[model samples]
Target: MNRRRTPRSASAEELLSTLQHLTARARQEVGLHQARVELAQALQGKMLPAALPSFPGIRTAARYAPARDGLDIGGDWYDAFLLPDGALGLAIGDVQGHDVEAAAFMGQIRIAMRAVASTAADPGEVMARTNDLILSMDSSLFATSSFFRLDPATRELAGARAGHVAGVWATADGRSGITSDAGGLPLGIETGQRYPVTRRTLDVDGVFVLLTDGVIEGPSLSIGDGLEEVRRLVSAHTGATAEELADRVLRAAVLTGHEDDAAVLVLCHEVTPRDHG
Candidate 1:
């Protein structure tokens, strides 16, 4: 009798019930995640997000991804605005920690940056003033950032870096690589420090990218190798729109594992053909 005994299979009703429970659980989890994200953003109370700002001959796009196990938020932030002189101001940065204070500090830094940029002559002065402002806060927080003044007519970017990652660039016609920008210490460290300004012009149809280190360097990836991978990707995907390009880069980083909060800003230079009339 034992030799002929076999396990009984579950009925159709039982299997169906199990599937239904799993589906409902998945939906519940997704809703909870969305609620948490909204709550966190509401708590921050400041919008440092980089929404696309319109400019002649330029299409701007940005993406932000939180750490894998983060509170669905962190110190990473990106911002773009029109300067008083009509030039476009672009910035991306990360504060020293990942907490409520860090998020608040990031917001302050952005607001101060815009205020200083209104009167500052160039990217260098903007950063120096922001640096001094942070020191005045009396908080021990430090941050790394990149500030750029983009000239729409000339297609030139005047930029300054403060102990942050150098940006990457590419074109619609297959030219791509990392930018070489000299920089100074992270903000909030010294009372008087100078950040070098790097200026470069983009050819028509070319694109310039600004990204936080979280997008490239990870636990399983080295910054050097990650830079090369990004270079190859940007060069190969030449026909993508600014938004598409930004998403593709973020997707790649997610695949590698997002060890920190990530943010990227893209400037797509588009030139219109002259009218035949």
Candidate 2:
């Protein structure tokens, strides 16, 4: 003969106790996640330059915004600093993802690039050396970056790209086009990658826009359409100040529902009354 067993029914107090335990665990998890996000954002803020240094004959402005979807802290960054030899070094890059790991990787790469800018001969050397450094770190994350060295006195712009977005060059008269001569794979893709240096004599009255892909690319927009939109925006702001133009571009991208973090750095020679005369 076999006997059937009955399931035990818990008392109300026991059930309440179990519910309380689960609630506490849930709260703990949420708290931990929030803390992680705040830490990541704070780290990002510290990594990015707080203020752009003033250049005598050049106007530069940069803007960075984290993606609104995820933790709101991402790997997109922009930097502009004066080198030892009087050249202005401008860099913008995006790591592989928009996570805490990606943010950490971006910080490392930005710091390394800044340290190398002092001794690196040119933009090509900077990218090449940075690529090597990232590889040596044994990191799995890769980054797309563009480095430019501008001589304000001579109006000479030399730069190199590592699978990054093409820069835009527009004169004060509204003539505009993309500047992407020397381009290669993103950093950390391989052990040895050479970034060709592209040299251009930028007109004193023109603007050089270096940006991350997030400004133009999003879930809803194709890359081609995004680039066209950016070009149109740039063309419309032919005579706007660098700060104004950067603000407009960043606002447009955000309002249009850009799904990723975005960064923009605008460089233009400051034309004085003497130049016009």
Candidate 3:
């Protein structure tokens, strides 16, 4: 006897229903992912400085690179503005963490630091006050920052660092490095701790490069190596405009797998004098 024909494994209707369910799930997942990506993009755009301030006799350029694999924004930031007294304020800071919380904290710290600098004129005292403010908040939050007051007339830079990467001064002749003072811990570490200031009289036609750790502590490169790279790049591009040189250094850092948030600020003393009519 002919064996009963095996029932069809699945009716066309049943197969179609299963496929529809799977497609719906996939679409929902895709929609969620897209929303996340859009949100991240918006956040990243917001985190960066919308417009850098313009100062007389100063051409400032900044670049920020977020981690290649993660969110596009982090705690790295830069600020440059002319003080009321005609002195220029140059600053770079990194909040202790990443994301929205860190960005908010960075904004607050940067604002407070600038306010103090504008009024105090002493980099050390500004940093000290900033540290005190940070300490007053939750101890868990902290930041690493470097602030500099530039006097175009005097060609002097009064600087203070709070656990930030050191500032490098490179001249057409040679390269010199400046480090933060000892016992100057990162902000929010302790109240009443003093962050010492360092003063340097930059040579005319010299270039000062300040950057966040994202440029130095990159993968496949040590801090020293990264710094050396910066020195070399700056030296090679001595003839390049300050903005162009800044762009080159930032590009080099990004190429070298500096996946964290990165920022760079450069100050170059123009060799030519402006005609004051």
Candidate 4:
């Protein structure tokens, strides 16, 4: 008995054509992904401040690193500027998502917060005002933020939070711990929310470190462990300048290929003869 053989549905020529088409489509997809990544990074870079403001007795520094995965854009951002009242304004925040919309929302929020802070000069009020502004936008977005005002002349520090990660306060002798106060719901989540300000008289030689969650939540470590690692790294650089310290913290805590963007701000009040007197 002779058996009948089944014919192949796809010829060699057809298979080759299909493979070629798939290869071309793959290349197109890769190109599109690259363009998106580039655009996102550029938009984020423009949104963040190029340099932090400086003062006589206070040293300010900030660093932002884009995500090395996905779109290379995230909502992490930090800003420091001279307020109209002569108080240094510092803020670090992370918007809800890691898309282009999130990045654009972050820029608007940062600008709005700065404008509010320049006039209000109150950390709690600034956050509250920004919260109201975000609600007015009518977008499905929210953000966690820490807003602070520091008087370099008097070494007075005040801050408020909207469900953001706590900052680090390091003494002159290298001891450090989390510094956080009363916090309210994240901004844009609820209108007319109240954020209570926390005030502290930091030592003349103390440092206040503000950071986004990406800094304290490492790829392979828990937040607690990451905090400890940051403390250790910061302790080793107690004598470094604010900029140097910021760089060191990023180098030690954040890696090159982070899953999320990382942002940090460091404020240091150096003691002088007047402070001693």
Candidate 3 TM-score versus the reference: 0.83
TM-score of 4: 0.87
lDDT (Cα, tens digit) per residue for candidate 3, span 127-203:
89989877776747788888888887786888888888876666666654545444378887778877777777755
Tell me each candidate's TM-score.
0.83, 0.84, 0.83, 0.87
lDDT of 2 at 207: 74
Q: What C-alpha lDDT, on a 0 to 100 scale, does residue 57 get in candidate 3?
A: 46
Candidate 2 global CA lDDT score: 0.83
Count backbone overlaps in model 2: 0
lDDT for each residue of candidate 1 in 1-277, tens digit (9 for 90 to 100): 5697688999999999999999999999999988887876675535565355866667788988776665667788888898877889999998877667788888889899989998996899999999999999998899999999988777788999999988888877667889888999999899899999999886567778888888888877888777777778777775677789899888778645677888888887777622222
Best by TM-score: 4
| Full ranking by TM-score | 4, 2, 3, 1
Clashes of each: 0, 0, 0, 0
Off by over 4 Å in 4: 1-26, 254-257, 273-277
The weakest ten consecutive residues by lDDT in model 2 span 268-277
Model 4 sits at a Cα RMSD from the real structure of 3.7
